[model samples]
Every structure is written in C-alpha cells, then in structure tokens.
Target: MRVPRFCCFLLLAIAASAYADSEIPFAAFELADSTDFTTNAEKNLWLLAEAAATAGDTAGNTQRASLDLRWEASLNRQWRAGFSDRVDGHFSQDLKQSDSLNTLREAWLSYRLTPQTLFDAGRINTRYGVALGYNPTDFLGRGTVRSASSADPEMLRSNRLGNAMIRVQRFWDRAALSAIWSPKISSKPATSSTSLDWGASNPRNRLLLSGSYRLAENLNPQLLLLQEEQRSPQFGANFSRVLSRQVLVYAEWAGGRQPLAWQEALPRQQWQVRWRNRTAAGVTWTGENQLSLRLEGHYNGLADNSRALAYLSAAAGSGGGQNTTPVVTEWVAPRRAALLQAYWADIFDRYDLNIIWQRDMQRGQNLGFAEVRHHIGPVDLALQWQKVFRLSTHSRVLAQADRRWQLSIGYFF
Candidate 1:
C-alpha cells in the first residue's frame, strides 16, 4: 500500500475530529462504515474499499482500502485546531512497484489570528496539490481538484512536511487570495501510479498563487498561477456569476507550458477550459446540498521529451517561499499535440454523479469515466469508475476501467 503516509495521517485526523455520538453496530463498522466520536478520548472513523476490473496493468482485478479519522475543536474563540489521520493500502499484480501498500496522510493545526485573518503552518496540504480547496472563498462542486503533483509518486498534497501560508478570506464579502507551497517528499526516487515512470521523476518544488475578486454583484473572477522549477509555468483563471440567489454559473481557462521542438529544449504547454453551474437543493440532516454541472476540455502539446532540470524552482515549489528542483524534460505532445475532454455532473442532497469523455488528436485516443457518491447521516460514501478505450502512445490496450469506493464518517464537537 504505497499510501503516502503523511496524507493518510491527515485524513485519519479529519475522521477522528468528530463529536461524541452513539456507537455504530459492529456489523456496519466492519462493513467499513464511519463512526462519529463524541468525546476527547473518542474520535470518528472512516473506512473505504474499492474493487476494480481491468485496473493498472495486471489485466485482472484491483482494490483500494483506507481508514481515516477527522476532528475539529475550539481551543477558544480566537483559536481552533484540526487533526486528521489516514491509513490506506492498494493491491494488484505482485509487481514490486504496485504490489505493496502503505500510507500515513495528515497532521495539522489552524489558529485564528482575527475574525478576518488567520494562520495555518505545519505539515499542511499544499495548494499546488489539489484544486478542490483552492477556491479561497468557497467551492461548490464535486470531485477532487487535480494537480501536477499527481504525475509524481505522491498522489496529492496528502501529508508530507511543509508550512502553508494563507491570508485573508471573504466568503460573503466577495474576494480572496490563497497560496500554497507543495514540494515532493520522496525520500528516494519513486514512480507515479498513473504516469510513465521514466526512472526517478525529476523532483522539484511547486507553488500556487491564486486570488479572487468580485467585479459585479453577480460576477466574480479568479486568477491562479503555478510554477514548478525547471519544468514550466502554469496559469489559469475562473469567472463565476451568481445567476440568482440559488444559481451560480462559471467559466474557467487554464494553460501550462511544454518543452518546444529542440526547444523541446524548452518546456511545452498545456491548456483547458470549463463552464460550470451550481445550485442548491435544500439541505440534508448533515449539510447543505449544493449541486453543480460542469463542462470541461483540455489540450496538451507537451507529452514527450527527455530533458531533466538540474534543479527545480523552490520559490513557489518549496511550499510558500523559495525552493528549487532538478530540471527534467517534461512530457511533450507529438507534432499534432492536442487533447480535448468533456464532462457533466449532477449533485443532490445525499448523492452525486459525474460523467466525462476525452479525445486526444496527436495521440488519437478517447477516454471515458464516471463517478457516484452517497451521503448518509454523518457518513459519506463514494463510488468511482473510469475507462480508457483507446490510446496510441502506450503499448497496453486502451480499453480498461477501475472501480473505487470510499466511506467517511465525521462529527464535530
């Protein structure tokens, strides 16, 4: 279970940060359901398991299982603390790289410096890792935010070690700036589970700087930028409008650099766009039901290349400050070098679903994927399935799919 230990730790802490409550039945507990905590000594728990067909390479079956504890408590009005712990494992063909499983995800603390300002510095989740919480003010969508870190051995920000410097936030007033510093924590060289392992990945530091501004009573615009030393600079922005009290619409654009021809000497570039809609479907016993529909497309001209950075940039890469990494030639797209993707989703008070399709011109590949999630009481459950029908660059058959299931039980004191 190549579970990133630090990230597992964080998730567990989140699951553990529950308020006291009735104990769950042993049957349900064993089924990997969550159990909320009611006391300081007691904590909530989350368990997840997903079975897959045609996963990875083995051409057989695959599975993922994990347990997490989440918690949140007030030290006082001016101070609050949070803790999360996660433990997970994966199983597949006894391949040395993919066979074993293990990880410990999170451990963090957040303190309020003022009503409008605060500080979070610790082994925190970096902004460069996931797009989910990066919105600064609020995020009304389903599914996790993707990060370049995914191509690295690390799945996402998970745990690792570093400080996260966050500034002011205005959820209701209408503006925000959020920055994160995410660096690879691999003690040794590692390969990504989903990318081509061209040997030890070019380790580097990654940074993200994002801001949101309210331009009109109904419109809000956001700008985000990310840079990885020796690799390339990534820039993106989103414009969201409140169509009504209950309806919100958005447009987003993102671009990343790729190495050029000999310029392959230089990093190539990648780009994507999105249109989104969000609405409310009333509230459940647990939380608000925020629904969203999004259409997105992506293009990558940087896929193939063989240059390595002598060092990666640590400025944004190191977390929030200065950092660096060895330069490595990032992936480059063939002469055609263009990829496109589309997706749609529906979210309701206790359930959500998403559908996606993608096509790559240069590589001549098409892919499809879907995800579903269910929430009950303090318990959150999710199911995800993905299939890639065709790909020209890779040797393995493009037709493949994986099923993933997750459960999280949380309560706050």
Candidate 2:
C-alpha cells in the first residue's frame, strides 16, 4: 500500500535541511547527537507480525497470521530502492480449509532528476482521491476493502495491493502534475474464485494523468483524466477546503460513458452507450474534546434503481437467471445513501474509539460498526463488532449479512 502524501513534506524538509548543511541526506541516517540513541545508525529492515481471530454465528471460528517485512537502501544521491513482502497463514474452522502464501506486495525503484522531478517504476500503489470514507474519483482502483476489525481509513487503505506501473511527477511552485501507465494489468472479476492473473482475463492497459493546484490559503483542487483499456474515457475533479479552524470540507465528482449491465439482454452483457455520473460530498468537525465527526452522502451513477429492481425480480423467477453476474453484485443502487462516522481519540490517554453508522435511506435498513483500539509499546490491540440488517428481500444491502466480533493484535520490530 502507498503511504500518505503528507510524508512527502517530511522527506522534503529533511532533504532541504541536508542540503543546507552541504550534503545530500540518505534515508537510513539520522541527524542527532551520537549519545541520543544507543545505536548511531537507523536500521534498514523492518518486521511486523499480526494475528487476528473472528467469531460469528455463521462463521464459527477463523484465525489468521501474517508476517510483513520491508527493506530499503539508498544506492546513491539520485537513486533509492525498496521492497515490501508479506507472508500469510490462515485457517477457517467453518470452511475446514487452511492455506499459506507469500506475496511480494511492493517493489519499486525511485530516481530523482533535479529537486522538482522524480520517476518511479515497478509495483506501485497509485493512491488518489480526497475523500475519507469513500472515493468515487479514484480511477486507479485504489482497492477499497470492508474489514470487520479495523475501520481506520489508513488501515483500510493498507490492505490494498499495488499495481505494476511507471509514474513520473513534476512539482512547481504551488502545483504538481503526474502521469502513470500500466502496460498489462489484469483485474479479477468480483465473483471470480480464481486469483487475479494476466491469463484469467485480459484487461486493457491503463493510463492516468492528474494535476493539482493550490488555489488559495485554505483551498486545493485537483483534476484527473483516465483512459483504461476497453473503457470509455473518464474525467474527474475533487477539492478540499478548510472552512474554519475546527471544520473541513471535501467533495469529488466523476463523469464518463459507462455500460448499463441491467439493460442488456444477457446478465454478463454491457451496453457501453450509457452515461454515468458519480458524486460524493462530506464535512468533518473536530471538537475541543478531540472528537472527530464526519457525515457524507454518495450517489453511484452505475446503480440504476428501476433496472436493478427489475433484474432482481426476474432472477427470483423459477430458475430464471442466476445472480452470478458481477454486474448485479457490483452495481447495487440503493434508494438513498448516507454515512455517519465518529471517532474519539486519546480516550483516557490510551484508548481510541470509532463508530460508523450506515443507512439505506430507501429501504430503511442499517449497518452498524464500532471499534476500540489500545496501543502498548510496540504492540497494538483492537476489538471490533458489526451488525447488519435487512428490511427488503430484494435489497442489495448486506447481501452477505451477518453479525461478527473480531480481535486483532500486531507487534512491530
């Protein structure tokens, strides 16, 4: 997964300080008193181990273990390289299955051309978007996952796998531009059981170009243009603003010509003539007590309400059609959509709590989630609970509806 963009500022600051002292700074070194730390040098290797367990009425018990390793080395002033690897071992009592696999999550090489231009290639996580809970304008497929044990946006983002691509970026006084290209990237169908492979299904290579400008002291805007293989061109824009010292606002919109799956004669068919528009807007507030609150509304253009209902009705007929199409599952149009989130940081100065409530305004159904986390030394512990509700038989909300409780722990070295 990609780190947050704010880290770039830290890197820039360090680099500038190093040049001020008449030297180029390496990543694995620190500017501090020799006696400040027991070790004079920073370690180039990092390791983390995590264990997670879940219990639910339907899923009796499930356990998983993961080991993550990262190593980085600076070859020269103009070149740097790093790799991240994860090994996973898991077993599910409900399914009576167990498996283990090792994955090279990310491996990239970076080259600096002057102080304002940079190039990166290899497996890269091209994370883009300005929204918190959801991002419709993230055309690079930032890969969002719904996890039971963690709702922190950062943790949710960390679960995404990177794509193979080459990227070039250039920075100006108050703006930046970037371009990315992936020659051959394949995407697995949401309903497919097989792993995502180049041979499973051939997806077109993709290209993205984006530009950002700082318009004012409190406002920044971005524009994104994307061209994917076998897909129509898409245009998107997003903006972030500081309304006040305690308030912030953000929004995103994307428009393009997309396929209408439900209108097609076959379930797997797509009529590419249809036009789609997706919109999301949200506001955040932080109180004196450090409680963060966010409320957002989203509209998914691909989800056609009448068409979705008609398709579901037909599928309910006597063996009329199987709901095996990814279109049906992926394009679920609810009558109404809204998200409410609240987070309390530094509770008792040691605990953090988060709550999320989702409502299907049209069907009057609800999905509730809560998580509590505690940090102790190099280990972090968390507990999560979720409840799903169904009000209509045809409603797509909570298709895999179930209540669950999960516990997870992580140790870093």
Candidate 3:
C-alpha cells in the first residue's frame, strides 16, 4: 500500500512539536453553496467535446464542505517547521461523481544558519508582486493552483499548492537576497483527489534569484531572475512607494522571449519566439472612514485579441476530448486591462465589504465581484456575487454573460 504524502508531513509536525518551545495548531470548517447562470452563446460553444468537459461547471448548483488544518512549531533556537492542509467534499445536482479532494498547501522546515542568514526546504508558498489586481512578476505561481472557491485574488493566492524547493536567504540592514532551486518530480499531473500533485508544482527544474533594497525612507525595490529547463530566462522587477500617510503606489514588470499565448495553448500550431513584456501599475488611497480604494492598469505583449479569438474558434470546432478551456480562460493574460477595488473594514461592528471590478480593454468585456462578510466570535458568514462577460467569436464579439452567487458559513477553532 502506498501512503499519502501529507500523512508523512503531519507525523513530522507532530514529532517536532514534542520537543519544540512553542507549537500552534489551527483548524477551520466551512460550508458553501454556489449557483451559476450561463448565457445561450456560452451554451452553444459547449457543444464541442473540448469545451464539454467544463460544461458542468457553467450552470449548476454546487455545495462544498471543507476542513482546513495548520500546524507551526519552533524547535529550539535554530529550527522551525510548518504544515497546512485542506480537505473538501463537493456535491452537485448535475450527474457526476461526488468528489472528495485534499490539498496540501504548504509543508516546510526552516533553519537559522546565522542570525542574518537562513535555509529552508520542502514545499514553500513563496509569493512575489506588489500589484493587488494582477501580478506579472509572480513566476512561480503558474499551474500551481489546485482548487479555488472564491474569485477574490487574495483567496486564490492563499489556497494554492506550494512548490517543493530548497531556498536560502541572507538579510542585511537595508537589503536582502534569496535563491531557490526546484526539481522536477513528475511528468504528468495527477488525476486522483488524494494525490499530492507534485507535477503541478514542479513540472520542470527551475532556479530563481531575487534581491531587494531600500533606496529611500519610503521606497523599496525588488529584482528577480528566473531560469527553467528548456526555456529562456525571464527578468522581473517590482517597486512600491509610500506617497503619503494614506496613499501608496506600486508597479511590477516581467519580460522574456516566449511563444504567443495562443501558440502555447495549441501545441500543433507553429511556434514563434519573441521578446514580450507584462506589466501592472497601481495606486491606493485610504480614508479616515476605514475605506480603501485602488486603481490598476495591466498590459501583456504576448496576447493578441485576434489570435485569442482564433484560438477559441478552433477549440469550439475541434473534436478532441482534451480540455483547453481552462488554459484560455485562466492562464492566458489579456493584452490590456484595468482593475478597480474598494475595501471597507469595520463598516459596521464586525462587518466588512469588498468589491472588485475588472475590464478587458482588448475584448471590451467586464467582470465584477462583491462580497459582504460578518463575524461573530469564532464563526463567520459571507455572501458573494460575481458577474462575468465573455467574448464569443472572431467575426463579431458576442457578449455572453455568466453570473454566480455563493453563500458561506465558517467556524474557526
């Protein structure tokens, strides 16, 4: 019998906690139900076998129950360990399997080589970027997401798989440097719910180097270089500045020689490599009323609207069973976009509101999401709504809309 990988990590965390100075354990249970509404144009496109795989996801009611667990321990003065895991059970009215999925979000060990240096190994959820709506410099985030219940960018980033890597960091008074190496573990992605899914996180051997420096009292900048097997190296940079006590600005950029987005999705298509750039710039303002507002602009040189339409048209006509819808919808970046966001904390006692609006400039489509949450003691309740407008064809852009509503109840212990 083969043992599950997360069970090993759980045992390790327990063993380390026995002799650790401090150990923290966290657990949470949540139940959510979602309803989706799809337009006629979208239903027509789903006739293709390639898009049929996701047809069940378009218009249905899905209910999910989830349990989240986390453990962190400080072993003596030189060592530390952490682990996070989530289990989900999903049910729906549409004919399908009642799936039970488990995700190992993080499992890592850290050692203090010196007071100013550190070493880390195992699966780590390292994140990089300064923009809130979009992140162009987050190179390690590709294909790492296992499951997402919410469309909120923050929630998507928090509940994703972490890559297995060895990392080293050195810190100084005004600067820091980090290096990471991740090795390939599997050639294909796993299909089982209980799988560790190492292929999604570490599909190829990769190396990353990052450094950050504080140039002024309110300005800090970070630079990065990433190299993967059989691919050209990519360069990235990000910077943030505090303009005033209640105002801030940030920018993130990445550039590399790569094939176009559509070509990457359709492997049979001719490949052309050229220099491309992706960028995001944003500013935020906070008021005394505990409300924060933000505006951001995004650009991607590798994406062309016409090519994206052609790709969709081809997929809609193909008879293959392979699902390429996810690649086009989730992985491909828009050529030009804009985002607006508003967050109000403590609007009422123990209540919060969040709203996000994004516009695709190239396709002239829009998406909007809003959520209202209430907290009472150890339990929380939330209601969320999302609206998405998508393009349908290459000749004429048909506006197809999909709306979704979700309600959630959660308890933390």
- For model 3 the local lDDT of residue 329 reads 39
When sorted by lDDT, best at the front, the candidate numbers are 3, 2, 1
Best by lDDT: 3
- Per-candidate Cα lDDT values, in order, are 0.34, 0.60, 0.66
What's the distance in Å from true for residue 395, model 2? Answer: 14
Q: Which wins on TM-score, candidate 2 or candidate 3?
A: 3
Highest-TM-score candidate: 3
| lDDT string, candidate 1, 111-186, tens digits | 6665756566434333321112122112111012212111111223333222322333334366766655545443
lDDT at residue 364 of model 1 (Cα atoms): 62
Q: How displaced is residue 121 in candidate 1, in Å?
A: 0.8
- With a 3 Å backbone cut-off (N, CA, C), the pairs that clash in candidate 3 are none
Task: List TM-score per model, in order.
Answer: 0.50, 0.77, 0.81
* Residue 133 lDDT, candidate 3, scale 0-100: 63
For model 3, the run of ten residues with the poorest summed lDDT: 26-35
Clashes of each: 97, 0, 0
Clashing pairs in 2: none
lDDT of 2 by residue, 5-119 (tens): 2122111111111111111122212221111211213455667798989887555788878877776667899998878666667679664897665555567898998799989
Error of model 3, residue 155, in angstroms: 0.4
Model 1, which residues run further than 4 Å from truth?
A: 1-57, 92-100, 126-174, 179-207, 225-235, 244-248, 254-293, 301-353, 371-384, 389-413
Could you tell me which 10 consecutive residues in candidate 2 have the lowest summed lDDT? 13-22
